[model samples]
Target chain A: MVELKVDQDKCLGCGNCVVACPVNGSISPETAGGHGPKTEDVIMMVENGVIKLFNEDKCTRCGTCPLFCPTDAIFLE
Target chain B: MVTNTKEVKGKDICVQRISPEEKRELAYKDDVCIGCGICAKICPTEAIELGEIGAIERTGVDESKISIDEAKCVLCGMCSSACPVDALDLKLDEKSIKDMAEYPQLIKSAEISDDLCIYCKACETACPRDAITIARILPERSKLVTGEIEIDKDTCISCGICEEMCPADAIEMEHHEPTSSDPTVSSDITVNKDKCVYCLICRKSCPVDAIKAVCRSCSYGDYDLNPEDSETTGSSFIDEEACVNCGWCQEICPVDAATVEKAFEGELTIDQDTCEACGACVEICPCNVLSFPEAEFGEQSDKVQADETYCIYCGACENVCPVEAIDVKRTAVKHTPTKSKSWEKQLSELKT
Candidate 1:
């Protein structure tokens, strides 16, 4: 099983990963529209300017979240 | 013989006047111009004409906000020197007079350090004029790792254990009634293909052996890659002509990467006695310095608050206020020392 790891120091809380995840778009249309998801049911979200992993079960393991990260903070290991 | 030429090249509008003794060129950047019409007003020959600024701004049409008459323009550089945003650039014989120290320059500058920048894009979001731009590049995901997962629905008991144990939120449990009040409590579980990261957490946590997951990279040969190849990298650029030196980028940058020297120093005040508290200034403020206090009872008060930390003193808020309660007093303007009498007069007019 691959592990999802986030380095807090490298994270700028940019929300790039959250918006890039397709699962987040399915959970909330706002994410697809390029804004943060308003609901709490998504795979990940930016909380207090930092990203927080919520429902990991909903992730398709598409590797999209880490692909769009500008800081390389989020990654699958 | 004398010759004149005009060329509009990708937002860089240029008008040239050539003579045997000297060559003069005036360049205007359509993207950098704020449509303030200051050039039109200051043009000595009245060659500059402003377009429908209000309509252009409303419709967001891709059109230049100002037009210049090539034949009438004398290329004196008056409008260029007078322009606040440096949208107009006048060059004499390949070099500008400002560069040669014959003309004064604005004492304003902006710097963004690539070393300190984290590419959070806060500056881009906070910039009042959309002057800051950010671009980011990341590694390809497929090249990094691969995995697969499958659920045996027939053998699955639908106990909701996998749903609870899943780290990716990829599982869901649904109940199916058997028509009668059957004690079996028939139920099933469905896996969301989009969310399943094949983490195997649900597979290990399940009481029954129903989930099968595999990490190809782990079992097979790991992808040969360097750590730096997986690194994210990008840069941010600020348009010199579009940036007003407002310090929004400096103030919003989380890493202290952006720095700006403001053009004008001033005090903005709203007279409470005359102010209707219509929040017009708050809506019109470009720097986001003015905002109404949060109402507790779902009803707003007649007071507005101002955060003066990043204010550039542009006078936009004052102009938009209908009650005439807002006052913007410019005490100083940042400009290089000048010898021109008319420029000094204009500079004096700014210092109220």
Candidate 2:
């Protein structure tokens, strides 16, 4: 079955996707994930920079908000 | 099953897939399209050659392949989104130079989305050549995609700074969980891809990764610093007419790019990418130093702190200022290991 992939370099943090997601954490803003034991995570925006430890378990896979990007920066694929 | 994207051989891809539902539902097969009007309009590139794709369009198979023109290309980068089949690519027209990098036996390139991202910009960025340019500009939300602190792979001495200040748990120093004995098999930065919005604050705070970061491709124009003039520089121009010198620019600038250059001159200048809001200069100045004129605070962002007194002009504060808060020509500061790190990395690095 096909699944959604969030391109980290393409996201703009508009919060448009967060607002559009129907499921909680279905579609979150992040990158790279590994098996539970491996602990793969994404770099996030900390105060004025990047935080590189976001959890994948937080994702809901919902494809609502990525559809609203005017720049096509956010996608559900 | 046919893939949602169809590849264009030599042409430029500029058609974005606006419908997330349509992308998720796209079916695919080998030689199925007959250049029929069916998938043509569906194709963002209009790249289908009639007889080229006849397998599935004729009815025998469930999918077909569409032939694409390799020459008439502009690379605005959108066709991958247009394909209802898994043929087109949404990646940049040209691949990364590393697309051809030779991995020594001791240095086998890690398999990134190995199933997909053969172009390893991240590894390049993480490792050496200052080689990483974040190759693929996937159209999802490119604007918010940049890292917060500047990780100048060139100067990144690997001394993770800006890592200490993260209160939101955003940055991290990824210890690549090696898939094998080769520590090089990058676990690097496993971005919770869906969780990050590319705020770029991370890029700025890294203390290590610093880039001028002005997206020249950004047509928004440059930093028309001389707002009094009519020229546009792609940055937020200070509209002298409307700019009441409220210090909004100073505060709004996450990098402290904007500064109250000469409050007496009634003009503030944006330093761009070097300013971190420690509020030292703002607090030291007796002239109600750089601040939002309206002084409005609505949970939008943390209010800047100001304590004019005790703010000795010894320039000591500015010297330690990570964001370069003070005009050195005007004051002084001492050397301190003011560091910032990816909060997420700090936490995870601290985690088991």
Candidate 3:
């Protein structure tokens, strides 16, 4: 299992990672049907200029979030 | 024994030394000095001290008394050159430094011109070194911090990326000497995620296969359920790694989701000489934004006028044209509906 960390101070709230995430876990169940699987678990969320991790367990460790982060705020261990 | 005596004569101040040989020295003239403090502020040796007099005199009035220590003065004339009022009469024969001529060797950093700045954070994002810090002033107390952008000179590499990204032309690469070829022509493709409706047309139209629309399908936690009885759900995602930044998606997007910035140097142009005026583009246009003048009997070609505001830049007209005369360097695409009979009817019905 990969450990994912988000530096809250560094997040610019650009939402690029949310758009780039291939997994449906980040999206809400209501909006997930059209794009991906409808799941109760959500991996990531953005609010108030910061990206928050909702369900770290649901993350697939695809390493897409850290790559797309413009500020390089997210890290994978 | 030699004693130095200073005497003020009208606007001119003369310093005289009383010894066997009397030497006369002329300092700054007070008549032309507006007391702007540019000289005192730019002084490297801190030789000039300007004293404030009153509240009314704080703003541009020359009520502040300026005392210059002759020992500390480097005679660099930087203060004299920076003075906006031309009050500092440092007899140094040199022209005012036009935008830091010697700054490349003397100073290595990026500087912002407050007067030309609009507080845009394009430079902040563009800086690879993360040296620039922009403190946004609150709406109510904006006057307190008009110019709040600070650049850490030590971390800055003087790469000039900030200068290129500055939309208002505010950031200056002080270390780089101004040259004819200094202005960078930056062309970037951008996406406004809010306007995107997830219409997959752009992904399908991408020539490089740069855009990937991955639709994930899964059954609701029922692995044992029969295939026919299970419900499948799906979502779209764009792969940034695969994207070549060709801006084809920007042209094909139905909404104003994607944009290509040309920075006013119009790259899109219709060649008048080669255009056959078959009206194929004008006819095929979905938005009715393209129109050409009615040709005379012998004329085979006429200029096509594109209403930029209404254009979605779908490239449908460009794809359908037979002559390939239209050359559109797709800069931007926007979804603006034209009011037709059907639209009016729909609007009227909705009003009720």
Point to the candidate with the largest lDDT.
1
- B90-209: candidate 1 lDDT, tens digit per residue: 999999766857676667788888888878889999888788898878665545555777888777877778888887687887766556565444466677765766677888987888
Candidate with the larger TM-score of 1 and 2: 1
**Better-scoring candidate (lDDT), 1 or 3:** 1
lDDT of 2: 0.31
Query: Going through the candidates in order, what fraction of the true interface contacts does each contain?
Result: 0.00, 0.00, 0.00
What lDDT score goes with residue B208 in model 2?
Answer: 51
Candidate 3: segments with Cα more than 4 A from true spot: A1-77, B1-6, B10-26, B53-64, B92-352
Q: lDDT per residue, candidate 2, B296-319, as tens digits?
A: 556443224433321222222233
Best by DockQ: 2
Q: For each candidate, what is chain B's TM-score?
A: 0.62, 0.15, 0.21
Q: DockQ (Cα-based) per candidate? A: 0.01, 0.02, 0.01
Deviation (Å) of A21 in candidate 1: 46
